[model samples]
Target: MSGDAVQIPDDRAFINFKNECNSEEGWNSNCNKSGITIWIQILRRGESIA
Candidate 1:
């Protein structure tokens, strides 16, 4: 599988998608581990992401 590289957000954030994860999944698995249901764009750094 291949396509245009996902541009690092304007903040020069680091993006990681192991086994191909969407933003929602990435956020749930990393940032917001609570049961709350909300959506937000999170720009993570290399050290911030798992």
Candidate 2:
């Protein structure tokens, strides 16, 4: 799996993730608190790897 960090503008932000899935499933999560936000992504493939 691969990910990146981005800057949000105007006290709010919209983010999108695009990728290809090959015999694997992807997961994502986001958190927001106290004017701070974090995003995460995880990819799993069979018991092998991302």
Candidate 3:
């Protein structure tokens, strides 16, 4: 799974993940509280791994 976040919608958006968190809760509080929206994407192969 991969994830992305946009702190701001305009050209001046901030995306420094390291600065936000080392934990999920920390990131949520830091980014979500500040009006950032988080996006997640899951990548998988059509064939099973054998």
Candidate 2 lDDT over 1-50, as tens digits, reads 55887655542332213224321245443777898856456545656444
Clashing pairs in 1: none
Estimate, for each residue in 1-50, the C-alpha lDDT of model 3 and write its tens digit: 55886555443333445534443442223234467767433336684422
For each candidate, give its TM-score against the true structure. 0.17, 0.29, 0.22
Top candidate (lDDT): 1
Clashes of 3: 0
> Sort by lDDT, best first: what order?
1, 2, 3
Better of 1 and 3 by lDDT: 1
For each candidate, the alpha-carbon lDDT, in order, equals 0.50, 0.47, 0.44
lDDT of 1 by residue, 1-50 (tens): 79878865543243444334444554533344567555554765654544
Ranking by TM-score: 2, 3, 1
After superposing candidate 2, which stretches have Cα over 4 Å from the reference? 1-29, 46-50
**Candidate 1 regions with alpha-carbon error over 4 angstroms:** 12-50
TM-score preference between candidates 1 and 3, better one: 3
The TM-score of candidate 1 is 0.17
